[model samples]
Target: MTTQATLTPAKELAAKNRARFPNESAEYRQARNALLAEEIELRRHIERVAERRRQLPPGGEVTKDYRFEGENGPVALADLFGDKDTLIIYSYMFGPEREKPCPMCTSLMASWEGKVPDIEQRVALAMVARSPIERLVAAKKARGWRQLKVYSDSDGSFTRDYVSADDADVPAYTVFTRRDGTIRHFWSAEMSSEMADPGQDPRDAPDPDPLWTLLDTTPEGRGANWYPKLEYPSAG
Candidate 1:
């Protein structure tokens, strides 16, 4: 692998960036330039991580033909793949005990609803919850999410096997591949709170949600006490 030093230095690339803002101080520009170099390196690191993920060998074969209760009716694990060879499933933290769906998961899905059509062109995407199908559908309708496909893992077999063995109210993002006549696990967001750095939230490297990405560019940077809510009262 080519090192950043061997290739063009991130500092040099950042130095070449002629972008400027109105009335920015020289000190700010200096600090911004330094930050830009780090951003360049971060971009490179992200690309490397993605390459490593793509290079991963075939994971465990999915032996269990897990069943799910879709809005339409019952569906199998293979049915979620549809015509695509790759499938991405988000195990929502909407278990029966919770009064409402997870706010973080809901925020992520709200962003995903619009991109579903474009994303489904290459890979199938589904959001599965341990709640009943009727409940999941109701929440979907209430949220005005039309593009995302929601499924209910009524038996908890799929959630137990792939998500949490104890049926914990934790969300999981897993990818699976269906090639030829067999299906196998691809990759999963295994990073947990235990692996997180001090003061940093447990999140995947290439975050699936746009909320964090957008906030990261701002000074506040995902406030510690702030979190998405199921519903917000109308300003009107």
Candidate 2:
């Protein structure tokens, strides 16, 4: 039978203390250096994977010319591309059932908001939802997001078309390119559990989520695998 962990008062007290490792022996030092080299090599491999993304062939056909509300009003699908050579459409999963914006999505977009100027210089980035324009705008305001250009697909067809919001497909980060009045898909990323690790770091920047930074303080140490969850409604 599986046993559930029970924390006695003493156990809980012990958990509050930081873990300390013993001094290493000469053999341990040699093994540690070799392991450090392996870690560096693994990071280099991840960098190479990121590099391959830039080399992907650009040509994902837009199956439908979906309309979306722009700052002025209704705008053609192509207008969303702005003036950039590449367009990144993030399919956000905030729907009627969600009740509130997703904290995980919020965390990712928070980083995007700060990079808008730099991103717009080379690529068009937009957050897409299947909700009404007003609803999407309201949620954006609630989240204090100013940098992301929001769009509403109301009909789930856009989500289905891009494989971005299906239960089977997790939130996707996809890049597309336009040529001769045609849009083509370039790259898509959806990391699987096998690819994730205890030390996995997704963001390339030094600045990380303050939420995670704070959570790293406790004994759980971010609890093996974790993602941000909405707190106002006390995450289901």
Candidate 3:
């Protein structure tokens, strides 16, 4: 770990950046350099938060043998770990009562679908819903997602315990760690939409969604009214 005393100041590092655009004004350069310094500090802050998360004490042991319905057949929570010691389960808002899934959850899942294989190399990943196994599989096929491993918490046992007590159609991200054949809850994204700031939407630090992250770089930023949808009209 690098101490703050030994690390160079973000502003000093930004001063060394000589990047220039054609015919750009001096004011633009000065502002950009200032923003660059802030960005550097943001990166350092992210690392510090990650380190703190990794140092968290061991969580509660998962006593119940929760089961889920996978594409192939029934599977237990322990089985989802495969050969990895860590497992990440994303509870998407696709309850049996709803005809379609939540657009926000869909957008997040779509972004992760392509990276599933790469992610599985380090830790097991599962996309779970409160709908039946058949319904979940159908949705996966409709979306043309080949890599994401969809599952169904058919009985809602896992959903009620880890996601929502009322079994509401909400998205959740939970992580579990397996050590010595015992499964334990490691961490979860507990921040809910109700926790959002006055102007900003509820979101976690180092958000997992690439869509919002990409939008953040634009001048317009992630607008208050704009949101992702299940489908968009074809472009001419």
Model 1 per-residue lDDT tens digits across residues 64-155: 97999999999999999999999999999899999899999999999999999999999999999999999999999999989999999999
Instruction: Give a tens-digit lDDT track for model 3, residues 124-219.
Output: 999999999999999999999999999999999999999999988888999999999989999999888888889998998789999988999999
Clashing pairs in 2: 59-184, 59-185, 60-184, 60-185
lDDT of 2 by residue, 1-236 (tens): 11244424433443344433588576765555565555555555566666766667655687687777655588766788878767888877776567776777778787678888998998888887766778888888877878889887666676776754463324556678887778878876656556554576553222234556667556677564667765447476
User: Which candidate's lDDT is highest?
Assistant: 3
Q: Candidate 1: list runs displaced more than 4 Å.
A: 1-6
Q: Count the backbone clashes (under 3 Å) in each candidate.
A: 0, 4, 0
From the highest lDDT down, the ranking of the candidates is 3, 1, 2
Model 1 / residue 140 / CA error / Å: 0.3
Which scores higher on TM-score, 1 or 2? 1
Q: On a 0 to 1 TM-score scale, where does candidate 2 land against the true structure?
A: 0.68
> Is candidate 2 or 3 superior in TM-score?
3
Pick by lDDT: 1 or 2, better one: 1
Which whole-number lDDT from 0 to 100 does residue 185 have in model 2?
80
